[model samples]
Target: MTTTLDKRPPGAHARPTPPSKGRGFNLLRYNLLGGVAGWLWLVVVLLPIYWIVITSFKVQADYYATNPLAPPTNPTLDNYRFVLENDFVRYFINSVIVTVGAVGPAVLVSFMAAYAIVRGSAASRFLRGVNGLFLMGLAIPLQAVIIPIYLIIIKIQMYDTLGAIILPSLAFAIPLSVLVLSNFVRDVPKELFESMRMDGATEWGTLWRLAFPLTRPALVTVTIYQGLTVWNGFILPLILTQSPEQRTLPLALWSFQGQYTINIPAVLASVVLTTLPILTLYILGRRQLLSGLTAGFSK
Candidate 1:
């Protein structure tokens, strides 16, 4: 390599020093501080997960006698035994049915509605209004309309049935899902959609064959998000269903929390068990879930 040194005198501004810093900050120190904060956050987030898993295995007697954070000296299956005998599995099944039932229709209907809103907004004033309404729904707190929801269920004779939970959860899931999917759909290239039309493809044909494949990531994102919401839902299950068989996982936690006393280990076990499926779901779809959520922000 050949070297060419500047022949300018020492005080001749030195070619502006090439900015030995970016924006006048010490970048390495800033990055190290950020790394420390991130690790601290990881520890904070993992601590509860650790405690719940460890506590779930401890014998109820040993749980009280030993330090709260200590690993069980004699870890036993007794709590799992107790949970199963009391129909924890049935609770799991009921949650599955409710979650699947609610999320399926929610995702499907939301996709269709979002497609219509995004594609038709240019031609139809009404659909633009409809999209506005859905975005508006994001502001309505769930607690505010919950009383009306409960009353509607009672009037329809759906109270105490799984339908009571499914119907409302589906309704609430739609607004957010439509908002997300519509953004994803709208971001689709205009040329691609027009090319399908040029080939004599019907609107529905274009939707399934073209829009769907492109938006699959957003769909998976919505499914996992809505499924988690409906799976762990407590408020709807609490207010709508009364029978033990009707109970979802959150409501079923009462099986471990007695009126006067609580089985802490068993309760934690139920929590850990209930969360496992959702954790698995997130693990599988986490990439798509995160990407879909931030899909349009880049533009």
Candidate 2:
């Protein structure tokens, strides 16, 4: 037998071996408790949604006769038809208008204010004070100041108008929007700002070209959040507006429930209809919203 001479460097370390596949399997198996909890939570959340959708398709008689969780034997469109014929279109349009009007201005103003605060707070005391004010607003719940808001709306002669709803929504939206957006703006590296300045970019130009694109995820997050708040808003609409023509979806849904108190299927159908737009919006911006929220929280 011949001994082989060692053919290696004097002190080179050996590479560590990769993890075995079974190790990953063992780790997953150890997390069975978390997996079980997650599944249970998912079922809890989805069960109500499933019932709402199934019940919307049921007739009033079947809804009473069948199991609450059971699917309809003979689904009907009459409930949806009844809801639609009862000024659903008008309420939808009002919601759209209020949502767009309020969210647009709120996001725009908040974004600009956030950028300003991030870029200029070092040199400006007013901006710092404004930021503090915004943070303070977060602690002020809508319920606390709703009476003052109502009085102001009345004083301004905006009572019972869509403007009444839009103005307060805009005001309430700003505080949280500013908080979320300013954090995202702060996360941007100073080097980028310096580079833009060295290239002779004006503040406005830098804002629109650089910061705006980078902060789009944050914008989408804010937009979705504020839109949902405004869309599902009941109190403002309830207190500010009374006319059927001026009613938003939430208020309309309340009236619909009262009108069809005995018709459970129609009530459920109206609920489904009111929820669809919001659900669609969430679906569209879900990825951006999640990423934005993750980034916001991580920072």
Candidate 3:
């Protein structure tokens, strides 16, 4: 009997291994199905926004004369010019102030409260109950409490001011931000707390220096989430502020619609302006936001 061992040299051509036909077909089928489902969902979600955008660009004639589905034949920037010259600038500024003011306090307070709930020795059923109450806040619609809020605002003499808007916005946002941040906080490993304590770090020091650094991504996620909410809040500002100078972008846009006529182009322009800041913010924090959400959940 002869023992044969074939030795192939480096870079020698070897017999080609045939790909698995079944596996390839399955992958192709799955990808095709996924692509179709995703595309359909996108179209469903985006069509309304597309309509608003298209209608906003339409001139007077196209708005009234042309079909709704047809593209505007004589699109113009006259509406945007009108908005810019009129109330848009002041409204935009008011929006920025209220949104910034609201988001800052909401995130800060929620973060502190969430940390307490997660790390405090006193964490118990009562604490859970309180947290539940705050969670219940998410279920309570602003409209249901609008009248009571108005009455309280009137009693406190805060109505028709920026404070009126900011106060209510903070109240509404705190619950959800707390809920989100608390879940994120609870995910932190106990080893980290033990390590910090062993190092003789104070509670404040531990939170600020150790835990906070790890929670940066989650903080960004909560900030961006609440920032959008505060920026786009309409009902609170609308009811709370009567002065045109105090109105935010949403209220100003609402006022733009009249019984007699509506400025289609300007409304679109204002929308584009209002939307730009949010889109820019999300883009800037996209990585942090995504990581925070996924990582927090995993933890």
Candidate 4:
């Protein structure tokens, strides 16, 4: 006791540890309010989807007779059959064409523009100006410009055609795509770009080999976002196309509703079918979409 030897390791000091909070105190800190809010929101969203699925399976009579949310006693494929038999296949194909046509070119052009803006904005006032133009486009709502767009489509003799829908959709899609893509492109390390240049890689070569690979999550995000916009696009298809043959899914769904006003089951069935492709696409690209969004926000 009088000559107590120092027992601690030479480099190790006795550090004070954080006092332990009991389980009750830890539990008190859990976000109960947030958890409750999230559950409420989940129910709000899923309830209608639940009703839609259940109602789609019911017969027209059963739709009126049974509870709206109840599963059908005799679930029939008749509603789906009815929808498919009514040139649903043609409208589906038209949607595919319009979505692909618009999204492909829009993404391609936006990617190139974004790459140029990020790479050249420092030295080029024009590139910076172009970026400003894109930012301004985000402020311009489609409704405000629809009249002008319609007039241009008429002037170009593209009105009442899928091309009319695709062109406007492509134009509208570009602003947001460039905005998202440019941020991702700018996040690439300047050192890596320098290394590429030192290795005699052209900007074009580096864009594809380096930037493209690194920024693929953003590309997928843009593609899916724009694709969904074009896919469920009601106003453009309605104004731009007049023929039944030119109708995309949203326009087709509207027409389907008008044609079968009393057949709620059939209407919901078409809604489900129309949504399937989009749902499939989202499922496929959801990971990339989330990662892209996270990366964007983090920066």
- The lDDT of each candidate is 0.88, 0.94, 0.83, 0.93
Indicate the residue-level lDDT of 58 in model 4. Answer: 90
Flag the better candidate by TM-score, 2 or 4.
Answer: 4
Against the true structure, candidate 1 has what lDDT? 0.88
Which of 3 and 4 is the better model by TM-score?
4
Tens-digit per-residue lDDT, 250-297, candidate 4: 999999999899999999999999999999999999999999879957
Model 1: weakest 10-residue lDDT segment is 254-263
lDDT of 2: 0.94
Q: Clash pairs of candidate 3?
A: 79-266
Stretches off by above 4 angstroms in model 3 are 1-27, 43-59, 62-76, 121-129, 259-262, 296-299
- Put the candidates in TM-score order, highest first: 4, 2, 1, 3
- Rank order (by lDDT, best first): 2, 4, 1, 3
lDDT score for candidate 4 against the true structure: 0.93
Candidate 1 per-residue lDDT, tens place, 1-299, comes to 22267666655654555765565477777988999999999999988988888998998888889998888898888777877788888888999999998999999999999999989999999999999998998898778998999899999999999989999898889999999899889889999999999999999999999999999999999999899899989999999998888999888886456631567888887778888989999999999888887876777
Pairs clashing in candidate 2?
Answer: none
**Best candidate, TM-score:** 4
TM-scores, all candidates, are 0.89, 0.90, 0.82, 0.90
Model 2, position 288, has a per-residue lDDT of 96
